[model samples]
Target: MSPRSGPPLDGAIDVHAHYVTPRLRAAMVDAGHAEPDGMPAIPDWSPESALADMDSLGVATALLSVSSPGVHFGSDADARRLARDVNTEGAEIAAARPDRFGLLASLPLPDVTGALAEVEHAFDALGADGITLHTHYDGKHLGHPEHEPLLSALDERAAVVVLHPTSPPCWEAVSAGLPRPLLEFPFETTRAVASLVLSGALERHPRIRFVVPHAGAALPVLADRIAAFSLISGGPPIDVAGALRGLHYDLAGFALPRQLPALLALADPDRLLYGSDLPFTPAPVARGLAEALAADATLTAEQQRSMRRGAAEALFPRFARPGPPGAAEPRPDDRSLRGDQR
Candidate 1:
């Protein structure tokens, strides 16, 4: 079938785009991840190709990140080296086209010390717009007490933390041999968010702006259920809906007809952001989804515009205005990056 077409996204900022450098690919392959996370293979990527895809999708800037399986395989030392290499490569990619690309650096998680060190380098030295974290690392979800130090550092910086889902610990038993992305990914996202809420991490790290991807996965549908049960379970006295409203959600995967509506029910409309999940989703498929979102009648034009660009501008104001010809846009100053709006 021919690809669907719609109005150009027109300066939209895609919050969930991905990148895989040669070093990262080689490392994954060496670690027996020739097929990372049970996928057929890692998608091919390059700066030129990414730029072409962005142009076709009308994305003025894409915040690039390394997707699941992350940098850690088993050894913390190896993971640290890989994380540094990939983050450096990502920073270089964004540096080449500051106006068209921004980076969300990866961390060697499940290794808190290494992660904290990388966080310092990624933000203070690399000028990363944010940090990309998986829902869990080494079977430990984001709310684990061990991650408190890392969380505290992020909170201090008011960092933008984008949560991408990885294969959950019980994938073998529960996945029925199917790829994790189909079912396990969203479930893992829900689990991680719940962990943060029940553990009081969300409350403690209020300054950290967390961006939940895949239209908040299963969180929207289960928000009320969680809130109702938390009281009985003696979990933190947090208002689930209010907590969701305070965080941002990205429309990256197939969000129409169900996910988007459910997410809107719990999340603030102004906190919605655009995400293309490119390379992994394939450019054509991502474009079709973007077209569908643009044409969805449920959202008013203003709402659509906000998802496309406005909300993201508030978070990454460096892209709000264009730079001079042949000049690279400056990295967002810490104050501008930590915009007043959540």
Candidate 2:
């Protein structure tokens, strides 16, 4: 762990906040899908309003990425165009307020070539902090051979890739009127992590730092089961627990007594980072969750502090409060860090 950059660095660094630009919102509305992926009505968001909420809630910075039902809404050409537009705008937002914003450039995945090209531009030209990827593109999850080249490229650069759960193509519909995110989102996250572990993608692409969303979804509860099956099957000697431990996790959704304890058992507690999942979870819910965490007896002040800012500061120190706070200046290598948080 890196040294703590104290005091003014006390504010939380939200790695999971989503940005819904006017154009992106309009595109969703035009798709004949007002409730994309069953997320109620799309919540409103703007950088100014987000910053106000951040200030009110003690958030120092909120790294932005497109939320559920990512930009690749069935047309490769449109996906590519939307990706470029979204990323360019996001990068500009981060550049405009480097201290309070960070960009995780959206890539047009399921189209490897376009994703690769965008990755190059995001880092080289836009100076984006990292890339965000969905658990599965089309029907292929992250571990599928189709994504190996892209993962390999990210590994070569030691990029921080954040994985958000998108409803998999094969998911069955539940009849209870429950939203997809109510259960499917977390399951999809587990499915992707399981895919990565079973197929050895996590092991092969060792340098790529993955950030798992929703407190690693169902990963903690399923850890032992995944391990026993993989090891006993006599496959490619998988270390499921080790793989889970190596990846980072965010406190999105509700990281309380249940999720937090399970997460700590699986990985270093220091790996925990703060996430608001704002706009989708909305500011009010986000605020309530934050207050709950602060009052949770299961976590210590030290532990909570780490979740808020300390751990994230170490993970992506480039965003550490700069100038007057006595926090260290971001080193040359700091730009390489990226993480997934929703």
**lDDT of candidate 1 over 1-342, digit per residue (tens):** 334453357668999999999999998899898877788999999999998898788787899999988999899999999999999989887877777789999999899999999999999889999999999988999999999999999999999999999999888899998889999999999999998888889999999999999999999889999898888886547777777789999999999989898888898788899999989999999888888887797678778877887788878877675542212233343345332321
lDDT of all predictions: 0.87, 0.81
Candidate 1 overall lDDT versus native: 0.87
Clashing pairs in 1: none
> Against the hidden reference, what TM-scores do the models get?
0.92, 0.89
Runs of candidate 2 with Cα error greater than 4 angstroms are 1-9, 322-342
Worst 10 residues of 1 by lDDT: 324-333
lDDT string for model 2 (26-127, tens) is: 888887557867667988889988887776566778889998788887888898899889998998888767777898889988999999999998888888
Candidate of highest TM-score = 1
Give Cα distance to truth, residue 201, candidate 2, Å: 0.6
Error in Å for residue 320 of model 1: 1.3
